[model samples]
Target chain A: MTDFLYNYLHVYLFVALFMLFCGIVGVVYRRTLIGMLVSLELIMNGAGLNLVALNRFVSPENAYGTAFTLIIMGIAAAEAAVALGIIILIFRKYRHIEGGDLREMRD
Target chain B: MNFAEIIFLFIIAVTMGGAATAVLAGSVVYAIMGLVVTMFGVAALYVYLNSPFVALMQILIYVGAVTVLIAFAVMLVGPLYRRPKEWTTAGKFGAALGVALVSLLLFVRFVTETFPRAGAPSFEMTTKDIGRLFFDDLVLPFELISLLIVVAILGAIMLALFARGNK
Candidate 1:
């Protein structure tokens, strides 16, 4: 069992894919801004997982995967900060953060 | 199952369970808590993949910083009456679940068939090597990312202050 896991790349790939799917579903199904943000983080993580897995199982010589994943983490942190800031601002303006109520541009 | 496999399985379960909770939980606070679990589990998976440095950063940045930021956002938004807003109808829920399942099955089949089963040779990637790569090969992007963070911090503060002023 250990060998099957540590020796196989597909396992990690499958897990990452599952995570991405979950994130997509969450994004579509969620109504609130914060909930959607959380799902977006999940999707980012899934991508990071896939990158590291491919790095480990496809190209072990270079530290490219790890570095790339670090870059992704940085980007995700910035995204979360900006997103939360926007959410806070929206809440202050509208007094609520529901998706349905954010239809100001609708004619 | 050997010790390592058991641990791997456990980590996967935790990761998936946490993600499920984060997405499915009714309360936003509970969803953030579940996100914490999922972040830690992903960090653990990084360790298993032989990148302990990334794992540590994952824990530090994601579990420590990002989760705290989210929690603060939740607190700032004030108390919320747990409303069944996300999945208001059973039909919507069922449709989303059906799409997720179908996509998952297709992805699994494509990956298993296309990707070669023979794993690449393993190698130890020390923190020093990662640092060297960051400084040497990825210096430009690294510096740019740092700049991005600085800008983001300033923007967040400005936006918050502006919002307060408008009130």
Candidate 2:
């Protein structure tokens, strides 16, 4: 069991995949903009996990994958900031942040 | 199982449980708290994967900054008292479940078939290595990320100011 825990690469891969799955479910089922944003962060996290896992198991010598993961973090931070700003602006305009109520352009 | 394996299993449980709570919780603040839990679990996993620097950054940027920002946004938006509308009906839920299961099976099959079972060789990844790489080989992207953060900060401030001016 310990060997299985330490030696297997597929376990990490599956964990990352599961994170992606949960993120997708959240994205589809969530009704609020903030919920969707949270789900999106989960997706980004899944991607980061995949990168680090592959980097560790496949090529530990090169720092490329780690660097990429760092960059992803940077981008995720910026994205969250921008997304929150947009959410605030939306609340200011619409008076609510429900995903359904922003249907002014639907017509 | 050894201590390390037990700890790893615990971390996995924490991660999955936190993610479930983040998705299934009714309150947005509770969801954000779940996200913080999930972030900490991921950071612990990073340590197991031998990337302590990334782990630290994950905790710092994610739990430290992003979650706080999200919490502040939830507060700024005021109380969301109305029950969130169920966007996915039973039929949609079934469809989504089917798609997720199929994709997961396909990915598992692809991975098992494509990759060899040889274990990863252990190697040390010091903070020094990460720093040197950032400054030497990956300098341009590093600089670009700084620029991106500056732009994002300015844009967020501008957006908030614009909204205030509209009042």
Candidate 3:
């Protein structure tokens, strides 16, 4: 795919920026904890895209970008697993997973 | 456009569309579905980036595992009802849009100004190269990542047990 956008860094960067945008807006607007978690995944993926894009475009000779991307995926998987577990626990205690209801901290 | 270019464009559309659905969907179940699509789209992009190994891992780890985990949480957490309203007001939403635009401008400028143009590479990094790297120069970070994963898994299990009220 020797398309202009595919070969260049501009499209990738814009896509990453859009991912970050969606993530932030989702975090702010999402009512459910699980929705926020989904948004968080987008944010993490955005970071990974940035890494790989720069790796391909800026320093084509190195694998650090790809390595960091692998690490990011690992961390993201860990984060999603942990966050989802916490969401389930909160739902168990409160009977719902909406963020608006979890205002006051309690045992 | 050529076939490959068309496919690339399609992938980008899938990614953007999926992300939009994920963020704007009314229910978490639908949101997870959108996320899975987005994950696949991103993995495809990785192929275009000349890192097929990362692309495979992206599909394996993201589309295979993470979305499944999210789907499980979605199923377990509560009844999936349509969200009636958002906690955000016009003011807040406007503020978020403002932040997004401002940050976009800044970051775009930074990258365009700083990063130099790159040409075609002589060698494409492969899975074997990555594996060799894991054992050679990147061993330390590799081991650290494994340790982090172990901790995360243990923590998740503990949390899930707590949720079961069977400590």
Looking at model 2, give its docking quality level.
medium
Chain A only: TM-score per candidate:
0.91, 0.90, 0.92
DockQ values per model: 0.70, 0.65, 0.64
TM-score of each: 0.93, 0.93, 0.92
Backbone clashes in model 1, listed as residue pairs: none
Model 2 lDDT tens row, A1-107: 32558567787787788887878777877778899899889888988988988888888888788889999999999999999999999988887887856876220
Tell me which residue pairs clash in candidate 3. none
DockQ of 1: 0.70
Model 2, B1-167: lDDT tens per residue? 77888888999999988888887787888889889999999999889888999999999999999999999999898776665543546676677677777887898898788767777687688889999999999999999999999999999999989888979
Candidate 1 recovers a fraction of native contacts equal to 0.72
lDDT per residue (tens digit) for residues A1-107 in model 1: 33567668887887788788878778878878888899899989989989998898888999898899999999999999999999898888877777767977221
State each model's CA lDDT, in order. 0.86, 0.85, 0.83
Position B52, candidate 1: lDDT: 91
Error of 1 at B105 (Å): 3.2
Tens-place lDDT per residue, model 3, A8-99, is: 78788889888988888888788778888898999899899989988887777878889899989998888888787788788778787778
Instruction: Find the candidate with the highest DockQ and give its number.
Output: 1
Q: Rank the candidates by DockQ, best first.
A: 1, 2, 3
> How much is the TM-score of the A chain of model 3?
0.92
